[model samples]
Target: MVVVGHIFWLSDFGRFAVFGFYILSGYLMTYIMHTSYGYSSLGRKKFATNRFLRLYPAFWAAILCSIVITLFWGSSSNGFILPTNLAAIIGNTTMIFPHWMPSQIEPRLSPATWALTVELFFYVAIALGISKTLKRTYIWISLSVVFIVLSYVMNLYWHARYFSIPAGSLPFSLGALIFFLSKQKSVRYIPEAILASPIKLFFTSFCIAIVTSIAISQSLSFWLMEIIFYFCMAINFLLVLSLAKQNTFVNGLSTKLDKKIGDFSYPFYLLHYQAAAIASVISLGKVASLKENFSLISCMLTFLILFIMSLCVIKLIDKPVEKLRQTIKAK
Candidate 1:
């Protein structure tokens, strides 16, 4: 959805998508650490190693792909910029290009990847046991609220990089809170309808909001959209918790599909921007503008290419890394 927003000039749903990613990351990381590894020194080392293996190999692959695609067929269009030189290639591979390099020189191979920088920082912080200070649910909740408030204020008055730090941090903290809350006895056994109905409504309203805002981009203000987005995300977080334990959807079919979806998600996200750019170049000629050339057919072509590419990377690259991690764990 975030990639779709970037490609199609839809409402600012990308912000919520990134925030949701942070929250999910926080919950999963915390759960894995608490249960699988605990807080031992050796455990932290293993955790950090597993994290790197899980993320970096695929990222390096994406960087290489972006470079090749951008070098031959890249055009700056609809706010998408491609890497052009060795410096960008190096910086993007490091995953710190947007943060460390000067904005003018910083090539946005995939501008959406700036969030990954923030996520990497959080991963390091968690591995170093910075989460020790946030044990109590109240503390986690309070910090989450503070971060969200700070993000909102920063976004109102500050530039992109400045707001991004807090914006990224906010959902991560919320994820920790959700994890803690899930451990409570009272969180169990909600009526299924309480969750299922809202989730259904959320998807419906979210689609309506995105389409309506894009249709009337002139009438929609940023602040108004922000309000709607946050409301949707809050409802989503609630749904995340409600459905955390109840995974069997008609005897495990949904769970298997969900895992497959998860396997493809990160690679798809990393590759989609460049894939869209490549699609534009293919359909509209090398030099054509993205806005002029973009159509339903181009979008479908991009999706097909991205899906196939992501599937291949997951099977060929990501799965081997996973196997290596499991082998190490077994040892």
Candidate 2:
């Protein structure tokens, strides 16, 4: 959905997909920290180290890939800088490029990495609160709500992109809460009928309809669509919760596919904007000019090529990094 929505600009699937990703991250990270790693100082250090290993190598590879694509196929004005623009590249290397650089020059390489920056901050927050999370989950959940409210207000009034931190805090909090609640022996009231295939199908179809409505409203310039979008997004939280509980036929299929597709997902997400940029140049001779929103064939072709390249990266780069992380963990 993210890939297609982005390349074609047809729907707000990218936005929806990102929200889902954030929520899932929150759940998985909280689970790992609480269950796998202890809340002591050494545990926190190991947690932080593991997260760094997971994030940085893939991110740097994506940055390099984006730069190479931009240099070969992108125009200078397309917000990507070459090796000659050392400072811009340096800022990106630090992953704080958006913080210090001007708004125009920010996200010059691997534009999607803004999410990674927000995610890194979340990791720090989780690490700092590991002890508190061990003792009292409620306090962390409260703070998460406060952050979400503040982020929402800032997003409404402020133009800065980093203001997303607070908004993202809410979903992350929800994920943590979901994990905390799911483990409780007393909270076992989930109806088996709801988890049945038919009900799951209904919920999935409803969510799809909501996404389609959001896209239609956005395209038609409806003021109420934002309200609807937010409402539907909130509903999506429940959808995720319900789906997580049940292992359906579809879920089983997805699980099998994720083994192959999951590794490519990160690199694909990181490099896709640049892939689109490359596709534009290949098909239209200009990065900014989109032929009819975007040329479907061109974007798909570019995405396929990027996917193959990402496979090479996963094997050559990500696999070794994973091994190195395992070595560190063993130490």
Candidate 3:
């Protein structure tokens, strides 16, 4: 959704899809900590190391791609600008200053990286034991609520929605709450409404349709839309991740296919702008202006190049990094 929204429909919903990623991240990191990396000192070290390994190598490669594209084959549509100052360059490369800080509005080579800055913040929080105990997790969730309410009251809700480090904890902490709920003793008897994947999918789709219909008919409040989007998308992602645990044939096959496609996600997220730039360069000046003359052919070419570039990064950088991550994780 982020890729489609950014690459093809830049005017629409690409940025909101990142909230779904935050929820998914919270759930996944919680599961990993409980199952493999415990709350011990050594475990904390390993967890932090593992998370960096998971993100940084591909991220750096994407930075390289972005730099090359900006210097050699820049495009106007993807907003690919190389930061001229040393500080901005360092901040962009290390993802240290992608926030909404007024004094530090660093030139982002890849616009998608601001969310990654948020992700790294949560990674540190998780490693610091915010997600360790159910009680602590609840505290984390409470912080999210407080931040949301305060931001809304102060008229900073939308601004804080994506880039405000403190307020952005809403989705991450909500995801942790979901993980903690599933682990409760009472969850063993969870209603089939949520436990069954088919039912989960159906109910989510039905609610979405109902919501869309209602939204079309009348003005639904912004909060209502936010609630619906977060609840629906979080569970939907959990369903996707849980497919691997299912014994059914279709579900099992879906998991296998999902794992393969998942590899493209990170690389594509980081390198997509460069892909667009590359497409623009290759279009023989046809894509001079995305607003007027960017053809369907240009869009498809961007997508194709994105996939090829992502696949190459996965094979060349991500695969070897994965092996090393697994080896370290095994310890």
Candidate 4:
């Protein structure tokens, strides 16, 4: 979904996918912290280290790709000499950037990485308070609501209404609620079909979400502001919870496939723009968006390069990091 959106601009799937990804991240991180890394000081230390190991190598590789692309086959309108620009570069290199930093000042080499910036903040929050999560879950949800409300009231951009830290944390909080939900034997209103066919339900909601996003973006209808965000978010929560709770052969197989694909997703996401840029530079004479010169052949080649580079990064970086992460899990 993210690849298609970024590489082709076919829909708002990339933006919406981040909303869903945060839920998955929050749920998975909460579970692992609960089960494997207890909130002891040593446990927190190990968790932090493991997260750094998981995120940085692939991020750095992507950053390097961005820098090289800028230096050689691309243009850098933002000069490297300004102190602010250099600071942004340093921040990007370290995978540390202030969430409040304006988009123009801290230019994301790949725009998708803005999510990672927001995500990093949450990682620290998780380490510090994942144990208290059930107790403070509503607080997180409330903050998300506040953020979304503020964004809408302020007439901020579409991304701001949903995926900024406060608004974005809604999905994460909702995702974490699944952890609480699974604990209660009495909370049993879930349909068997949803649990049995999580992907089907998810895709149906996902399509609705994409269309709703377009409606919201274009202001095709006014009711979207009041309704669509919550609807899409609730649907994602149910889908993720269904995936988490179900134990059947079909879901088991899907889980295996998810795990396999998830291993590639991070590097693949980070490399998507670079792949498209290279493809565009070849076929269209310069780096450009989907709006520039829509070419099926270029998009196809971008996917090919993106997939190949994603595989290479996994083989070179993520696979090794996984071994180290497993050692932490073993403890």
| Alpha carbon lDDT of each predicted model | 0.66, 0.64, 0.70, 0.72
What are the RMSD figures for all models against the true structure? 3.6, 4.0, 3.8, 3.1
TM per prediction: 0.84, 0.80, 0.84, 0.87
Check candidate 1 and list the clashing pairs: none
Cα lDDT tens digits for candidate 3, 1-331: 6676565543325544566678778888887888889888999899988888888888888888877776775545455677788888887778777545421364677767877777888888887889888899889889888877887788875556556777558788867766667654444444544545644564564456455435734766767766765566655555533432341424446766868987888988888777877787788452343334468888888889999999998899889989999999998
The TM-score of predicted model 4 comes to 0.87
Across 136-244, the per-residue lDDT of candidate 4 in tens digits comes to 8778877777877777788887656554566557777777778777676545777665666677668877787678656766755554543765676677777788767
Candidate 2 deviant stretches above 4 angstroms: 74-78, 82-90, 97-105, 130-136, 147-155, 158-163, 185-223, 243-246, 249-256, 289-293
TM-score head-to-head 3 vs 4, winner = 4
Model 2: which ten-residue window has the lowest total lDDT? 154-163
lDDT of 2 by residue, 194-266 (tens): 4445346446745764566556745744335545545555555555555555535354467658667777888
Which is the leading candidate under lDDT?
Answer: 4
Instruction: Return the lDDT, model 1, position 192.
Output: 46
Q: What are the runs in model 1 whose C-alpha is more than 4 Å off?
A: 78-90, 97-105, 130-137, 147-155, 158-163, 188-193, 196-205, 208-212, 247-252, 287-291
Off by over 4 Å in 3: 75-77, 98-104, 184-190, 198-255, 284-292
Q: Highest TM-score, which number?
A: 4
Clash count, one per candidate: 0, 0, 0, 0
Q: For residue 187, what is the lDDT in candidate 2? A: 36
TM-score of 2: 0.80
- lDDT: the better of candidates 1 and 4: 4
* Deviation in Å, model 4, residue 238 alpha carbon: 0.4
Model 1 Cα RMSD, Å? 3.6
